[model samples]
Target: MKNCCQAPARRLFAYPPTSKTPTPSADDTVRPQPTPSKQNRGRPHSGRGTKRPAIPALPNFLPKLNPGSQLVMDRIYSQLLLFQLFFTGSVVDTIVKNTNTFARMRSEAGKHFLWLPLKAEELHSYIALVIYMGLLGAKNIIDYWSGKEIYRLPFPKSVMSRSRFQAISWNLHLCDPEDDRENSQKKGTQAYDRLFKIKPLYNDIVSACKTYFHPDRQLAVDKRMVATRARIGIKQYMKDKPTNWGYKLYVLADSACGFTWNFFVYEGKSSLATGKGLSYDSVMQLLDLSLLGKGYQLFMDNFYTSPCLFMDLLAKKTLACGTIRTNRRRDQRGTIRWLRDGKLLFVKWIDTREITVCLTMHMAYDGDAVLRRVNNPEREWERRRIPIPVAVKDYNIYMGGVDLSDALIGYYNVLHKTTKWYKTFFHFVDIVVVNSFILHQHLSKAQNKNPLSQKEFRERLVSELATQSSTSEPSTSAISAGEPCCPEYFGSDAASGRRVCALCKLSGLKVKTPMYCTKCNVPLCLVPSRNCFRKWHTVGHS
Candidate 1:
């Protein structure tokens, strides 16, 4: 009551400036900066500061991918695959730099070694993948990446240096040990074969496919006998090694994704074509954990339908389904006595404008019970010599064996023989999936079985994270431990629509910082509640 009349005068004057910098915001915050000229204004300005427009909306993004290249002819070809091929093309460019040593690549293969540096400071294999990516484009991969940051690295230059040949030899050692570790030979005889299992570029292709595909669905093994158009070196058969005039490509792949996992290219003459077998060790090496599951199925053409191998797959609690070549007689074959399951396995005779296909149902042994007994030495001691004709030839001489009912097999077989014919089928499938997506997109149009919408899937993933965030252990190297673990790159986290971290709900706008977590090497924002900082994503960070 005493100061009421004079209070206005007391509040009239304000205090002076405090400090130059403002206090830090929450750790999760990345507060926006002011306009360029207004950033450090000394006092209020009526016309001194430059005005700026509001920030624009960001674009949308999605993460995760499929596998394969060539746009996938049906299930066999896919976008993920094409993307990978684009990557592999980069790796191939690395190897192509030294192609002068390999006679097979002697002819100028268009812009020979176009993107490769005449000299590099790092191992060719050590070059950042991004560089190769830029080098390999639908039209010109090198020209595309020339202006990118990755090309500026000194590693590329070091790798191309003559002194770094040791590294090239070392890489080849990982793929094949046959190469000379510390020697240089004339152009015609250079040990390019020892440097890499596949042509360098091809390995890049393989790597590219793997990044996009989900996992190895089923493993397929097949033998390709390719007669050369030149005076090729002699080699043993596909399996047994001695010497021959032709070469064979033993390819192993993920049945579900059609990504080539392992391929062995061997050269031999016909006289040396005696007995050769595929490399079991190589096949095992190429197996990707993504493809391995608690339960899995394997497929093979006639070449790998060995009785011993069959028993092994069953022992591993996995199923091995393949065509049984008519030529190979089973040791002990009596089918009617015991059979477990039967299904229609499609058979394709040819690949052309019009494809010829048929479905066949074959009886398969149900080794589910006492699977051990199938390979029990005690049970099979007498079965080895017994003649079993359980396996028979298909109508077409080119194909024979147990006709697997899987339509995927038929599609893969046709696609593998030649890719052009299968693409049409793939496009048709894409349309069907797209239409299905559209139907799911409109909730009202959905049938009793509602398909998940993009929003729904995102919500589900978020919910799953919430539950996982609580139960996950505090330590023990769980990816989700530190910051929300890692945010999906190119997914909603990085998408343009909103600057919110899909994971923590923190506005990326506030925490403009992009600090990376030391443990996981991921952007710190990905950490869910920093389950490491627990609640920190909310406001705990001091």
Candidate 2:
């Protein structure tokens, strides 16, 4: 009699047991095997040519784009959709308007040393700055903005002034005037909220992620540590991680494509907890409620896997597979039997190298077994005789999706080394960029075009987002051109107050003067040897 639920172990090494002692000794514990039912014997076996079930092909999750479109073009169009859904025009407008208000208030309050007003163009430039820094991999903000070693392929000289970039970096605010906790005395309200300032933007990013793409049948839940040494309350330390100190995020992503569908930031002790424990709560938080009852298989690691969690997921019609720790299993005795590495029975194969146990609501007989090679120091390596369970193999295959998402984020991470706690908010922006890139790749593939690589993707994305001049108001040079004498000269006036002189600014000269031509309305210095007014309105400086 054999246990129908467990597989019979197969022989490896092509040799009989060295000693002919009955495998189970008098003192050794033995599992109780059930009588084999006639129906169970009638089913197909796992041996060669045993008529195994065919694996169903995975469905394409990419939506169809217009035919004959180039990948970069499609990517640009797809980015527009992503921005609209996630970082909408209204959202940008609110940020810009509120930022301007905050800047004015700061200047009025004498907190700002320089009168740096936040403008729409600078906001665009700020986004571009983050992208440029991510792509270039600079040591610091200074190194990224310096022109000494610019990468010619993507970065051009003087794309933006370093001082202006620095100013924007210092003044970037995601919250509105009302939400700014500058003077709030509510102790408990602000104490635990790590992301209180940028909560709105964070919520919008999450909402956009949920709305933009639908995940595949298989999903993975895992934790990621965003590297930072900042003194924030939400900072977590995982000594095993390459980045040991940082903020932790629980991400739910598509297994096959690594598209992040939903995510939850792990705050301190007050956060939600499942009936089973913290790990269960994390899995539940990341998994969207609407995805239930869809037969989606969720893959996790030992930290979150337990028989109770599996049963809960099974009750919701969602299947789960993971490497479970010994103590977490409900059938501790049955699970321990599979932990020993060797042959179990004549028909069923068990190898402890791959899996301890694979749990499914129904029999996991739909997928095929996976081949694994075993290495021996004394002899040539050979494939293990016993095959790995399909559920176990699928769990191994899809388990890295969240890690893969983290890897992509690392290539162009927006979070930099900073003392400020709010830099964590910028990490979410990096997620948006990575998610948008994923959407672009899928949409491009649907159009049968080769998608842009991550490097090229960021280059194009930054250029597109930053190229637009602000239309809401005139630039600082125009206002600082100091009152155009006539309406005809308004076109030539420099709106940017930061502009010293058109030639001086372009020539990288340090000269500064406020004089301008009354008719042409162009800013130029009137120094004894360097009168630039005539050259400003003329055909050529020469």
Candidate 3:
């Protein structure tokens, strides 16, 4: 019995040989370990009664963007436009240099040249003049230079001489003669080709807009009238506009800030080949496919809103809200009149405008909830319900972007009759200024900075462009002792190739000098004894 008791004590110290799990002692707590199974490959183990929630499915429509995002788009566009202008200005400067040289050569050959070559500074001043004329509301160029009795201050003559200004304005060429001729030859098929004289500038501006500026969620498309009575082939007439007779411009602008992102002048049947007419082509041109899939919304009037168009936009992942004409919609059925006041109704049907089928969306507001002030019997104004369609309300709210852009342009438009082409050029300048201002406002809001007003911005821009530093003294130590030369001394190389130095020739001396100062870009005597480069640049030369 003593030996059996000793055996039981030995069994307590050793574990039993079985596949079952071991029992825990009273002092220890047992925790369960997860089993390796295919079903639990991706998921981690949770404690008992704890469950993970299923992830929700992505909806068909993207969430509406915040208002701040629109401002960001505007800001980006503005910077791009400015960058394009800088490049354009550089190219123009080079062209002007070459043209001036050519003109001088022609003049020397005793050939009559109509266009006088202009300097970059002069071009800058001309741009400033255009802006100044718009802001001052001057009737003509001469009027601005020549102050009227009512005018307290005249345009400073020192900024740009009137004659020089006129010459530059009249001869402002954005392209070479060869390109203009080539473009003019193809003008019959392309209405835009008629604007080939300034087509390069136009293309640059358009490219800048496309690269940098994107419209906000809500975009508006409409026709704008650039006021002018000039007889041009491309000019269009819109009877409804205040300026009924002017160029018809199809504008794509942001609904929030009225910033014009892209535009094209409506020329005629050729431009309207898209079958949807002026409205459709304009919208297609303005629409960026990259922006479409991001849930952008387009707002247009009856002219652009068609059943097929709406479906096309929706298919591309864009939402459109607009007013539609009865003929524009293909569906004739379910066109019910809202007898029940103040209710919004939707009608959906298959659109069969063309041979192919399309999707159609229609919404109507009974106008019962619309209110207007009324004069009561007590002779006091009171709010009263006025029925207006919901479509009308939405249209009125979003359709004003084009109107706003027009207003901004009209407030200080810079177009006049020098030539029809000049009118286009000035119009472009107006666009650049307005777009720049929009960008300025956007940046200010983004950075929490104070923005300059449009007027202030223009003034600063004009000052920077117009001011050229001609007084950068020559670094040559040899020319420090000479008398200051006349302004005419620094003029463009003379037409007469056989000419002598003005100083040397005036002294009744006949001396030839091949050495021309690269800095001054003028011919001067660089003889061992008589160095006119030193004399010309110096202040006390004979």
Maximum-lDDT candidate = 2
Question: Candidate 3 on 136-240: residue-level lDDT in tens?
Answer: 776756665553576534444556655456545545667765556567777656433666566667777766654445566667888887777788887887787
Off by over 4 Å in 3: 1-87, 94-116, 147-155, 186-192, 291-293, 326-368, 374-382, 386-390, 468-542
All candidates: TM-score = 0.31, 0.68, 0.62
TM-score result, candidate 3 = 0.62
RMSD of each: 38.1, 10.9, 24.1
Question: For every model in order, what is the number of clashing pairs?
Answer: 66, 16, 10
**Model 2 alpha-carbon drift over 4 Å, by segment:** 1-84, 147-158, 182-184, 189-192, 271-275, 291-293, 327-354, 361-384, 470-542
Give per-residue CA lDDT, model 1, range 1-542, as digits (tens): 22211111111111111111233223422222233343333322212222211212221211123322222223322322222233333444444344323311221321111111222213223222222222222233232223357544433232232222222332221121123223324224533342233344445444543443333334566554332224334322434422232344555554433334444454322232323334333334344434444244455554454444444444444445544333212222221111111122221111111111211212211111110112333454221111111112222321211121122223211111112211222222222222222223332222234446533432332233223222211222334444553323423444432232222322223442233333333233434544422333333221
Candidate 2 structure quality by residue, lDDT tens digits, 514-540: 454443334566566976664444432
Is candidate 1 or 3 superior in TM-score? 3
- The residue pairs in collision within model 3 are 367-387, 367-388, 479-534, 482-538, 482-539, 482-540, 482-541, 483-539, 483-540, 483-541
Q: Pick the candidate with the highest TM-score.
A: 2
Of 2 and 3, the candidate ahead on lDDT is 2
**Candidate 3 local Cα displacement, residue 345, angstroms:** 7.6
